[model samples]
Target: MQEIFSAILGDQLGPFGPLILMGTLGAVLILFTLPVLLKKKQDPLDRLRDQIKTSKDVANGKAPARLRYDNQKGARLEKYSAFLEPQDEEEYSAAQLKMIQAGYRSKNAVRMFHFAQFAMGLGALALGLIYALLKSAQQDMSPKSLVLTVLLPGVIGYMAPKYWVTRRIEARKEEIVNGFPDSLDLMLVCVEAGQSLDQAIIRVAVEIRAGFPALADEYEIVSHEIKAGKDKSVVLKDMAERCGVPDVASFVTVLIQSQQFGTSIADALRIYAAEMRDKRVMRAEEAANKLPTKMTLATMMLTVPPLLIILIGPSVYDIYTLLNETNF
Candidate 1:
């Protein structure tokens, strides 16, 4: 087998040709076989239905079965969590909060996140070292180049999970912002229709779910928390913290103050909902106002040059022709 691989790849890969070929073939085999080995017995449709049912259960004041099972799964991670998770309380809390904001409320999410970073960094570092060794065997490599090649992948791999989490947080924030106005309008309607605040939230969650699932999910969680006999103020504050949106924080403040001062909740919702709509419109206008500035460079780069060339080409061509004729 070594001789066969050497005969096939020795010219391109040098002395390590057989070893590299076997390693590559082994990786490919794992890629193909791992999914089969890990295949689950549950049908995909059933899994999706289960998720939907879990949401419905929460909305109806029942504890989600999925969450109960997740607690059990979380216990498995707890055994090694000290190794997998950050030891600093502040750092761990910050990471957990980020995970929550990114819509991952699982107890094991932070543990899994740190574990992923470690696994990816270790794997990438190994691959990088192997590649550097292969390259060094093929050609002379400076120590600096070798160091860079080995460390760059490891650094990038370690940070990739954090980057993904940041992107998720941004995307979730944008979705919440876009949907908040609509949800507020729906809540306002529910409130005006004589439903209590808690009922209004549940209704709004169900009604706006098709269009704005993230915001709806937040509302659903609030409803579930409220149903569990938690203090309404604390639940609202928790929702704001989980959302990390200024608009939501303000809304929570409004609700809290209204309750404190004996103001009508319906009136508060009505006023705040209108303000939210205005804010949404203002955001749209602000984006539109910046459009011209954003497009100015693109317009010049793409349109002005072509126009200039079209206008001057014939004149330049005529001048060149006249100069040539005069010389002739």
Candidate 2:
């Protein structure tokens, strides 16, 4: 293979053909094998054991192991977090909020996100530089092209993490929006059925997991926080912020006000759930109303040109044939 590579690229690559080929093969081999080697191995029963332990801990009114593990991981990350996080307090908080809203609530979430951005950008820059070098060696590459080749990938890589987080946040918001009304209805039922607000929240979280895991997960967090003896208002408010949904914010306000002004919780849930159902209906109708306008361009692009050709093609062909006859 070395001889074959050298013979094939002896002129272009000169004496370095085998070396380049060997390096490429090594890189490819590492690319294929590194992930498998780096992946942490877990026993098949590990998840079951963790689940059983967590259930027992929760039943015994103790903090779950998962939370402790997360805290420990966060502490470990903190030691090297200087370069892994934004220096600006506001930016750090914003990034953390974004991460939470995107369904990542680990304390190391911000650090990991920033690290991903740095790693991706650096890797892309290196790859671009390697490509530029190779191309320059293989053939002439204009300076503008070279600069673009070296910089474009880095810019895109630097922005990719943010782009992904933004998309995740949007997708989570949509899920929460779509599933929230049902959750509200269920919560209302739970409240009406004589369960306390906390139990109702936990019940809703459990029930809603199949259809809308994101909203369910948020409810579960709210339930856990409430169980942990956090101020209910603060917990609700934090949930609202983490969700970043207006409906959720309004729901939180309603609960807070109901508690403050001595209004009935069941009544508030009933009213809010009705409103949410109505809003869901309205949203569906709005989407339906906009469908034709959204489809108009597609309709024209797909249907009109072929239709015109079908209608006018014979006439145009006849005219062309007549012109040719006249010219001849």
Per-residue error (Å), model 2, residue 196:
1.2
Model 2, stretches more than 4 Å misplaced?
A: 1-80
TM-scores vs. true structure, each candidate: 0.74, 0.77
- CA-only RMSD, every prediction: 10.7, 10.2
Task: Give per-residue lDDT, candidate 2, residue 3.
Answer: 74
The segments of candidate 1 whose C-alpha lies over 4 angstroms from its true place after superposition are: 1-76, 311-328
- Residue-wise C-alpha lDDT for candidate 2, range 78-163, written one tens digit per residue: 65576678889999999899999998887789988887887798688768767866876687666687768878998999999999
Assess each prediction's global lDDT (C-alpha) against the native: 0.86, 0.87
